[model samples]
Target: MRAIVVTEHGGPEVLHPSEVPAPEPGAGQLAVEVAAAGVNYIDTYHRTGRYPTKPPFTPGVEVAGTVVAVGPGVTGFAAGDLVATADAVGGYAERALVNADRAIAVPAGADLRLAAAALLQGMTAHYLTHSTHPVLPGETVLVHAAAGGMGLLLTQLVKLRGGRVIGTVSTPEKERLAREAGADEVLGYDGFAEAVRDLTGGEGVAAVYDGVGRTTFDGSLAALRRRGVLALYGAASGPVDPVDPMRLAGAGGVYLTRPSLAHYTVTREELAERAGDVLRWVASGELKLHIGRTYPLADARTAHEDLEGRRTTGKLLLIP
Candidate 1:
């Protein structure tokens, strides 16, 4: 099978295409014929060694495809079932192994590309809005990089919960996209904290869904109201520096949480609920997925570069 292997982590140039042995389904896993793989910031992190991994590993984590073989003890899935998972062992390949427990059945007519695009970021949005702080009606919140893949989803989901979104984007085009995604107000990254304060009449927001870590962390903290939550989810620009606990207390008694999707979906039931909602929304057209671009599996390096450069919007996919 052809796969993108990273023997050493340095940059996007390190993601090389190579021939490798196909992965087989082990106990409680399913081997899938890869249809599409989702390109995400985490993949770039893996490539750059920020999130360290052993050498000679594939770099993708989300995939959607048809099952080719089922392992022993796996139930409720067959060789031909359409499935998607955000927890695949190595998705950037012709074939990948997924733990059956973490896999979700795609709806009868759901597009495989959309499924691949929606699972990881979609479920992350789910846990962020539905579980982490639980957006309350009439409350206002801030979302950083509100035109990116995860940002678009977060904006729409926040509106679905009847919350107002004040999004921060880097350009006018991104501001337009964020507004289309239901952001009540969109501002440039420069003076975003002040803009948020002005939008909220000095009350600040109930929460801030921040994915752009280092560049937006202090501003996100500044934009929160008393007892508000700052959910530091991703570090697209760069990882944030260590903070003193006193900053949280001094920032109007705000709460800071560094949450991950893995911790949010610890059980099969939780995974199913989050994935189910996102899948159903996409299938029913209630949640819109904007596919920014598609790259051939071998061009994984370019995909990483485009993503890290912030030149693409919405979800990016790799067709195998």
Candidate 2:
């Protein structure tokens, strides 16, 4: 088997495909024959030492594939069931041993690649819209990185709930993608705070989902109405500098939260429920995955480069 190994963290170049033995499932786990692996910004963080991992680890977090083997005591699943999974390690390869509890059955008609793409970021979007602050009918939302993978899915979901979406992206092409995904207004990433203010008639928004991190955090906070939620989920531009708690109060009396999918879906039931909602939405075409790019298993580093360098949009995947 060939898998991506990060023996030591540094840059995208540190991710390389290497030959290794295939893994077997442990108790309550499933050994999946990896068909597709989801790429995420956190992968870049881990590789670049922004989020450290011990040496000699495979880099992917999500997988979509067939269950080839089930471990002891696992129930309600078996070989040949198509499934998608998240939060486990060792998915950037031909196989992964995923906890059965974390696996969600992929809808029969969902494209395997699309299902894989939807697992991590899609669910992140789900909990963001549904749990974190819960976008409401007629409320205005501002989504950073609005053309990116999670951004687009979240925009559509917010719209589905009748919220008005204002998304921020770096280019005209991305602006088009955000608008297509139901963002009522799309602003250039450059000077986005002013754009957001103008789009909202200077009253600001009900919430701001700031995935772009440091580059937009303060501006996003400024672009909110009193009591608006500032959900900072990712740091694509860079990590936010140390923030004073007073900043939240100073900026429109806002509420600030830094959420990750892991914290939101802490239990097996929570994971399944959120994942099920996303899968159902995808299956019904109410939510669409924008699978921007894919790389063969061996090209994992290039995939990371493209994702981190802003050369692609939506979810990036590795075809294992």
Candidate 3:
């Protein structure tokens, strides 16, 4: 098997490709012949030691493929099952092992590449819109980086829930994309808070979903209404500074939360439900997935560089 291994924490150069023996599934695991792997920012964090994983490890968590071997004690799955998982490790390889319980069956008509691309980001958007704050009809919400993969999905979900979306983007092209994804108002990152205030008649939005940390954190806080929730889910611009609790109180008693996909789908049942909703929406065409780029597995380094450079939009995939 050919896999990209992170031998040390550093730059994209650290992602070195090598030939190795294929891994066999352990108990309660399935060996998947990887068809596609989602390239996410978290993967870059792992490669750079920002997330603190040990060296000499494969860096991927989401994949979709056919099951080639099922290990002992695994049930509800067999060889040749088309499955996808957001909890699998070593997904940057041609083959990866997935815990059977964590794997979700891809719907018959769903594209495997789309499945892999949407699993993590889709579920993240699901919990953000449905659980974190639960956007209600007539409410207005702010979404940062609203033309990116998660942003587009979040915008669509909020619209489905009847919330009016105000999104921020870095470029005019991204603003158009955000609008197409159902954002009622799209603004440039500069002066977005003031724009949000103006758009909402100075009352502010009901909530703010901010993934671009550091650069937009303060603006997100200012864009919210009294008691509005600010969900900080990523640090695309950079990691935010340590915040004081007083900041929340001063910001109109607004709520603040930092969420991750793992915490949102901790249980197998929860994982299935969230992932199923996302896949169902994709199948029904209610939610569109923009797979902006696809690279061969060996081009993982270039993928990381492009992602970190913010040179691409939508979901990026590595085809194995």
Cα-based lDDT at residue 106, candidate 3: 84
Candidate 1 on 172-261: residue-level lDDT in tens? 889899999999998999999999999999999999999999998999999999999999999998999999999999998999999999
Measured against the true structure, the TM-scores of the candidates, in listed sequence, are 0.98, 0.97, 0.98
- Summing lDDT over every window of 10 consecutive residues in candidate 1, give the lowest-scoring window: 106-115
Best by lDDT: 1
Q: What are the per-model numbers of colliding residue pairs? A: 0, 1, 0
Q: Write the per-residue lDDT of candidate 2 for residues 139-164, one digit (tens) a residue.
A: 99999888999889889989999999
**Window of ten residues with lowest summed lDDT in model 2:** 106-115
User: Which ranges of candidate 1 are over 4 A from the true structure?
Assistant: none
Q: Could you give the candidate ranking by lDDT, starting with the highest?
A: 1, 3, 2
Clashing pairs in 2: 149-314
lDDT of prediction 2? 0.88
**Per-residue lDDT tens digits of candidate 3, residues 1-320?**
89999888999999999897899999999999999999998998888888999988999999999999999999999998899998887999999999999999986656899899989999999999999999999899999888888899999999999999988888888888899999998898889899999999999998999988999999999988999999999998889999999999998999999999989899988999999999989988999999989999999999999888888889999998
